[model samples]
Target: MIELKSPGEIERMAVTGQFVGGLLGELSGVAAVGVNLMDLEHHARRRIKERGAESCYWDYAPSFGNGPFRHVLCLSVNDAVLHGLPHDYVLRDGDLLSIDMAVGIDGWVADSAVSVVVGTADPADLKLIEATEVALEAGIEAGRPGNRLGDISAAIGAVARRYGYKVNGEFGGHGLGRTMHEAPHIYNDGRPGRGMKLEPGLTIAIEPWFCATTDKIKFDNDGWTIRSADGSRTAHSEHTIAITETGPRVLTRRPEPGEGAASQIKQAAANS
Candidate 1:
């Protein structure tokens, strides 16, 4: 079910989102060459515990995913777009890594993901990463009230298609609130004005993932770690947002570009 949040509930979710936001920032800072994917998972588990929060991914078992993710965060590296199970993998120069994380605070869940180059970043890698960021931004720009979910999906698709990449529909963004995943599966491509209509308190995740080559994907033998079928590079970026009376509110906003607290959220207004 798609749950609409009360103003008070939105406030609680924002608090939870802020923690997720902070953790992504910390992880990006510490992720370097030679860093093991499992090490990041260890830190994520410990840090969430220190904050008195529970990890939504640790016990997550969605229909398409393997039983219980067994880790607090997903460490998806180059060619691996989503659900990358952490293992004894070591970082390498010019490798792109996408870290997807989620946590639950008082039963409310927030999900977010970030992609970055491991070390000695390559120009092509940098471009793909930037494209994902731009796609995510476009998706966010399309999340305003009075709009349909397709607007956001189209926005993201435009960016990926512009860069000559096809989307993997096998997995995409979804409604997020009391649970990590919820109603109204948001695809990477769709017709505008189609699907669900945006409404106040409607919270959802807008994640845009891209593969350098074809859209085909293959899950690793490990049962997770979705990678590009052709072994091309990949990048992912995402954010959870809420529809408000006036506009859209990005719950998982990070500190940047002079975005002030409470005011960082663009296209938003007082809830009705």
Candidate 2:
């Protein structure tokens, strides 16, 4: 069943989303050449401890994933696209990295992800990352009330095709709330004016992930990570949003570039 969040519940989710946004911002800034992926995991753990939040992925056991993902971070580097487990590998210049995170605050959950290139970035890598970001924005823009879920999916697909990328239909966005993943499976491509009707008080995560080559993917030996089938680089972008009577409200917005999501999470931490 599709669950609609109450006004107060949505507000609680905003706080959770804000914290996640800030966490991703901080990680992106520190991710650079010579930095070990384990270091990023430690940093995320520290922040979660300080804010008194719980990691949704740490103990998450999905059929597709290895039992109980024990890491606080998903560090997908280069060809590795989604659910990249943090190992002992150190980043190198021109390497592309995608970080996906989810945390629970006051029993509400928010999930988001971003892709970045360390040090000197390759032009192709930069373009791929930019495409995912813009596609995410387009999906969010179509998330207003009265629109169908297909509108958001079609909007994302249009952006991907314009950039000459293929969408992986296997994994995309989904409804998020008290749990990390929920009902109303969101695909990256669909026909507009179809699917479920968008209504006020619905909150969903919109993610756009694409590859430069084929839409197929292969699993890593780790049983947790997934990558492009042709070994081509991929990028992913995501955000948690709320559908309102007015419009789609972005709950995970960062206050400024590289500032992290400091506006509400910091204030909430101080109050707590």
Could you say which candidate leads in lDDT?
A: 2
Error of 2 at 213 (Å): 1.2
Candidates in order: C-alpha RMSD to true structure: 7.8, 4.6
Worst 10 residues of 1 by lDDT: 263-272
For candidate 1, the TM-score is 0.91
Per-residue error (Å), model 1, residue 220: 0.9
Per residue, candidate 1 scores C-alpha lDDT tens digits across 96-189 of 9999998989988899999989879988888888988999988888888889999988988898889877887878899988988899899987
Error of 1 at 35 (Å): 1.3
Best by TM-score: 2
TM-scores for all candidates? 0.91, 0.94
Give one digit per residue, the lDDT tens place, for model 2 in 140-225: 99998999999999999999999999888999999989888888999999999999999998999998999889799999877899
Clashes of each: 0, 1
Off by over 4 Å in 1: 256-272
